[model samples]
Target: MNDLEHVKPAAAPKKPARRRFLLSGAGLAGALLVGWGVTPPRQRLMAQAPLPVQDGAVALNGWVAIAPDNTVSVVVPRAEMGQGVSTALPMLVAEELDVPLASVRILQAPIDKIYANVAVMRENLPFHPDDTGNTRAVTQWALAKVARELGINLTGGSSSVKDLWLPMREAGATARGLLIAAASSTWQVPPGQVRTQDGHLFHDASGRKASYGSFAAAAAQATPVEVPLKAPHAFRLIGHAAPRRDSRIKVDGSARFGIDARPEGMVYAALRMSPTIGGTIAGVSPVPVLAMPGVLSVIDFSGALEGQTGAQAGVAVVAHTFWQARQAAAALSIRWDEGPHAALSTATLFEQMAAALDGDDEHVYHSRGDIAAAHEGAKVIRAEYRAPLLAHAAMEPVNCTAQVSGGKVRLWLSTQVPTIAVDIAAKVAGVAVADVELHEHLIGGGFGRRLEVDMVAQAVAIALQCQGRPVQVIWSREDDIMHDVYRPAALARLEGTLDGTGTIRSWSSRGASGALGHQFVRRNLGLPAAGPDKTTVEGGYDMQYAIAHQRIAHSAIDSAVPLGNWRSVGHSQNAFFKESFVDELAHAAGKDPVALRRDMLAGHPRQLAVLDAAVRRAGSAPPGRAHGVALHQSYGSIVAQVAEVSVEGGEIRVHRVVCAIDCGIAVNPNLVAQQMESSVIFGLSAALAGEITVTGGKIDQGNFGDYPVLRMPQAPRVETVISLSSEPPEGVGEPGVPPVAPAVANAVFKLTGQRLRSLPLRLS
Candidate 1:
């Protein structure tokens, strides 16, 4: 059996509920504030409970376990969403433990405070990258503490490796130290005399050797001695292209995704959601559906759960099989209350945002020098850009299997936030959090979709009516597309001025969009996050270009579209708006686009190097193709891309994309390259044809035919160049996504002489 199929028969040690944890945190708030200056960050090296050791295996701290045969198991708390985290993260441990990578086994982690995603939360702070003042520092410190206390195990923001870099390595080193100490004691020698390599301890002087398994029991009793992490030069697994551990299993079809989950006496449920956003089921006609063959029951799924704003409450048809349930669901008639957003439409949303942009409700997120003074007597250029709401469109449709029996709940699903999932399950099932057990599966594709628990809540709600039997709730492709928490539609108005020396003296960008972070906190954490939202103006406000007078503002417009984080969050669209406008500035100044960007990036060497690398690697486009370049930084990584494009049969054909990234150090250079290629294709799909429109508060597109992704024939040849850097790993998953759209859009301008300011780049 695969390691993913293994689960401890005994119940894991209980952890505090999220609500109770928050209440306790509130109680300690006063003391924390008093000792704010001296309190250290929470230690992540140890778990709150012991590791779930298998038979004949010994626990070695919270992260690793050693078995009788010297097999090692490393617990990875983050979701493996085809990002190679399942491979890259274990390399961190294997490198420090001085073991061959193949000897380590991957295990899904249970709920633990030590696995909280503090790095991604810190990245969400509304401070500019250049802002290193006390306010930024203090806010980050407090936020990190809050994140640790909350302990929401999230897997997005490309933060899995970055967050676990130190903790995982330290865990390995700590285990290695304990084993060496145990071996040295047995040999009657000094601790330094026993060296560890390849899962074995050696006392070379005495010629005594033993496997780590031999010292496992002794190591558990030994007091842990602090061990130093391996320097980069000594690393054997990291910084190399280690094969993805999941590749073989996935290739051979043994990898289990959420949809593949099977439980004894399992039933299938087909959900028929409300047609409109925020709508609820008024009544379900069960006459014919109840009489249908294999049909179990028609369940009323009405009312939204807490923090599940904009999620549709509908009816579920339960049956013996998915096919039966789907047929019954389609045959049933359900009345819906369309709610207040019945008249909402995409055009109206744009109108509302445009009005907000012109109004006085905007907050200036970043301001440098005097924009008015710098614009005086300078050549002014102005433009507007728009990006439509987008769907995550992950390969696997949303699904979850829930078993509510004997006053306990068991959940099997693919989720990016297991902690949040457990909370939602407990609350919905009316059970103590400890009574809820979650079996997280490998996500076919997350791309930020599984980060929400609305689907989990919906599944559990349907399962409750199954009368103690397990029900696997599956969403049809149409259901998944219509009910998706979509990426926010955004619009930006930009202005720039060129001086007599052809230098950009002033830059001002005003963006309008639903505040994703604020909405996310409301929907995910059940808290209203007020004040400035960093995600609303990230790529625009945090540009690396060294403009003297720069002002970036954002107006948080209210909409019923139900905003959620997409692949790159705000940077996905903001980069296109900011970089396209920069290209406009370059064209107006009669300078090469790359050259103008290079001049402005004089102060940012890493960004400049990445930009130059893409340009140089691209060299020149093939005959009849033009090249366009863009640079963007997000999640502590800098990425630049050059798109080669041409117009054929009235369609924009991108023949190639040359990408360069400085994501600090690529833990797995092969994964880095794969991510770059994936990002380019994903972003290209959005730029070329991806859009989610709404009419009368209803989602317009339901399946891929209408909302198409980039097919293989349309996928551009992607050449990824990784910069050799000594900096700590940043993010490869999302940083590469922010640059591809702008690069392709700018390239289309060179090829067609038409500036496409909107997404799905249509020819006029």
Candidate 2:
């Protein structure tokens, strides 16, 4: 494979110089004093329990804190699941705050209402033009309903920084404005006369200066104003590559992941859940586990919250050590009610979905122009695609530490939804949500798996049963793999017609998938069924391609298997189906995939721009390499990926991948590049080697040994080309995922002359 490190830079001109700012010591002191003084003593006291003010710093949520010593602390709301949000998010806040990257310290934000993400709420609205419901009116109603139900918009749908981009920067800018206000007041000068730079506030003409620390207390009293954000040309720290704030801590093993947490008097708990989905505990005997070494107690826990299927439900063995708990839990004898899903099998699920696809029951997600006439007047090509159920396989598995005392419960866990964790823990522990204090620790990885609060509830239950002792509930790799909220298996049938001139005439896609709404309804509303799931219809309804005559419909089939969001949610599977079918249509029209896509996307300048750049960077036609290109829009970003592949000894070898992304304005180019690479690897792994097969309602794969992730040796060389634009920053975490699988699969088709429709593209 050719080394990408040696690739020459493209002919694009060098970027313009960015605006620069540095906070002086006086500015820092002024900001700190204002922050301290404005924050009431009562509020400070309320923030004290389980909320630690780091040495030399005053706390503000988990992300932003000002220290008496002139340092800034930034709390990261989302876990660093290797997607680079940890670094990118802080850059957005620090850029407008006028603090140097080095002066800012990143802290994991605690799970609370204040820190909940708002983007998920917006995405949940049924406002798309395709829906039959009064799209505008229903959207407004749904938005209000989502806000009322969720309490706080929580993270998911790759909307961490994108959701917070404007708000968080506005927060920083608001704080800066207040600091300047405070400094001006302290100096007895007009606010307009005071200029803030770095950590210091200065009256340049008067030569008077004060550190932000000195003004912080006073600034905290000033009501935040609606200041206009800085223009793109004024961005300094945002566009540039700053060293990752968590790099040093992660490299030094000082980062506290869920597994690293150990509270005082902590005991370990291990559970043996039923082998089937929706199973419940029927009977349990503690006598078998009590005599085991280090076993403290064995208790039956059947009080799980509704709608959390696949969670372990049975007796838990609590002990001094995790190993002891595991041993005792394994040795304990228990009886389970396998529930109604005992007869479930993967084959049965596929059959049920196929039946749904053939049935008259369907929801029209999108429709445009005259699809019937277009199809009747042209040559048509059709194909069906299938994607299997998948597990999140987060590196840390599922674990949480909880201590319940009296009416209060304290929790430490690596959770994407900390507020939800607290709520569920409070419910399980029989306390108010406010009484549950959650310490959001660094996650080993989340990937949408931690969004569920089952583990948190389990920990609370175990802790409550342990009297006042803290109990850490740990899920082994086996437990995590066997019992997880899986990504839904889907079947998509596509029909595309081309005119005699090779112009596309009609496009139609029919899909059957497990309901994502069911999980939401079960968790949020306590209802067993909402209407048909909207998530199952996302990518099809939101297709960015300019196909004039098109229809996308979905059949929401009930599955015995439990399903929830994976990394890219619905797009992970839908992108493969849509793009691969597009490639097939391109081939049928006797056109190059790139050229065909460009022709179809005549009005989508941003999408076409990324597609053209990625193809150029990949060397449109390389020697001994077949290239496949796919462009997709998800999470408000357009990404185009070109994969170069070669088949050797019946194994598909991916040599390199060139990715071009137009995520509007990149906060940190290096971080964007890194996340793209990470997303590519993650998506590629799922395409070539990921699947969770089941038999008799039990997962066939147990650990990494059976369900393998992509190893370093199999990883391809990744090259990312970013487009510079002045538009608002879109999502970076999941946009890269949608294009990878289709790109690679199309390349494999080019090499073999045979289309591989399924995931884990096996050689037959």
**Per-residue lDDT of 1-764 in model 2, one digit per residue for the tens?**
32212211111111222211111211212222333433322111112233355675554333456778878777667666666777788777778778877777666565444455556655563335334466555443434333323445356777777767866786577768778877777778887788778878899988998777777667767654345679999988888887776788889989888888889999999988888777877766676578899998876665543333234566678899999999988887777788877878889888999999899899887788988888675778999999989998988889989898977988888877666676566556666666778777777877888777778767776676788998999999999988888899999999999987777778999999888757644653333455546678777777867788989999988677777779888889999999999999989999888888899888778888888999889985566679988888888888999999988898988889999999888888988898899899999889888899888778888899988888999999999999999988888888898788889899988988979898878878
Using TM-score, give the best candidate's number: 1
TM-score of each: 0.96, 0.89
Go through the candidates in order and give the C-alpha RMSD of each one to the true structure.
Answer: 5.5, 12.3
- Where does candidate 1 clash, by residue pair? none
- Once model 1 is optimally superposed onto the true structure by TM-score, how far is the C-alpha of residue 487 displaced, in angstroms? 0.7
lDDT top scorer: 1
**Model 2 bad stretches (over 4 Å):** 1-65, 107-112, 126-150, 222-227, 303-311, 524-529, 620-622
Model 2 lDDT on a 0 to 1 scale:
0.76
Lowest summed lDDT over 10 consecutive residues: which window, candidate 2?
Answer: 19-28
Tell me the lDDT of model 2 at 258.
Answer: 86
